[model samples]
Target: MHTSVSLKALALLVFCCLSTFAGAAGKCERLVATGNPEYPPYLWRDPQSPKHLIGANADLLTLIGEELGVKIEILYTGPWSRAQDEVRTGRVDLLAGAFLTLPRLEYMDYVHPAFFVTPSVVWVNKDKVFPYSGWEDLRERTGGTLVNNSFGQQFDSYAKANLNLEEVPSLTQAFQKLLLGRTDYVLYERYPGVALANTLGMLDSLETLEPPISSEGLYLTLGHNSACNDAWLRGQLAKKMTELTAAGLPETLLQRNLERWKVQQSQVVAPPPTQDDSQ
Candidate 1:
């Protein structure tokens, strides 16, 4: 009777464990995600479907969902700031792409082995190009970038301490300022900046200097407050990300999306929205 009772207890414990695992997995059946809506190639508001975001990051999240048997929806929650807020409050479960930072770490858990490394460069109007070889070259010059944007923690700290950068609400505004000669240069990621310049019809006017300011890894983050923030979901995401990165899938997706953005841009003759338009 003693042995039988012990066996029964073991069975009950196993059953409880399975039940807990299933419960946790069930809560993650559908995840809502958001990110910087204007970040082309990586992420952007689908011109055809403005309510949804479509880009390489969105494609990656969709593949992750397929592998994990969870449905992930990347939405255009609002601007970059509002998207971060949505993730912070658990209104959204995922950040499609984000840079690692101390403040952001407070509200999100970064997946290990960042999926992509992005290079941020100094963009200047072609007619006003300067001899920028390093960070020190911009010590006294004024630069501009989208508000809440970060190149990397090291660069962010350095810029705060030693650089003069004006913050603007949108990339459109930042580039506009650069073109108008209001700012010496605008710091932004390479491919996305290229894509945006192409869309804004400003590609001929802009050029990026060599020796990029910072090369930072972009990560997919799970909100700290998300109901789906369980060990199972986190482990699965990290595992799939590691597999996909190893397979070199992100690069293929980025190139494909670059062409996709160009095709979409060609279809629309009217200019894209601006900072004032968003406000």
Candidate 2:
């Protein structure tokens, strides 16, 4: 009887130890993802709540955290260039949404099957005219784009070589220049342009050229040096993405959040302008 009890106690101890190790392994406290705080309708700071970030990508990340049983802490890093640097140097565990580029592959591994597609399009003022069939058609026209934004590395290169392209700080400024007749065309992402135009009440003034220049898939990229770099983590993330896609979680969530943003924008009461005595 004592022998059986001893064996039972030994088995219980072994199971307890294994359980403790498994729990420790699964204890994921915080997940860090880098993003530009200025990019609107995708990843941006909430105007009313500056400390809180909001956008489609931010909502998607929150959903992902819930589905994966992990806590996500967003680090509002500036600009795509700096965000990439953070991901590359292991300062951030992942980049929330990033286009797959050759240079990026050196520092991170992309999750299989991108989560979203962004179509690049050219926006032109309704008053100024141009017959644009493609990038080639814009050779004679002046183009504008964000300073560090890449429609595509190849397309950017072509624009540099073939057109008189001006780099600006933000797409909002690019559109301003376009409206003021400073540039003939501005290239930007179609969805974002739509949201931004609506926000600035410039939808009627600017139009997106049909037939997008190119569409790129955006993925959640894991840092090469992260603890979650193993195949198991990759598989887990892939499974989570598949489940989310199957449930149409990405689209539904994005639509709902976008509608909220639209309502918020509409409710914003612009302050009445004061009369200028100098004028």
State which candidate has the highest lDDT: 1
Cα distance off (Å), candidate 1, residue 169: 1.8
Off by over 4 Å in 2: 1-27, 38-40, 152-157, 160-164, 225-228, 269-279
What are the RMSDs of all candidates, in order? 3.0, 6.3
Point to the candidate with the largest TM-score: 1
- The whole-model lDDT of each prediction reads 0.90, 0.75
Off by over 4 Å in 1: 1-18, 24-26, 269-279
The local distance difference test score of model 1 is 0.90
lDDT of 1 by residue, 1-279 (tens): 999999999999999999987876756689999999889889998777778999999999999999899999999877777788899999999999999988899999999888889999999999999888999999999999877788889999999999999987778888999999999999999988988888888999999999999999999999999988988899889999999999999999999998888888888846435335353
- Pairs with backbone N, CA or C atoms under 3 Å apart (clashes), candidate 1: none
- What is the lDDT for 227 in model 2? 67
Clashes of 2: 0
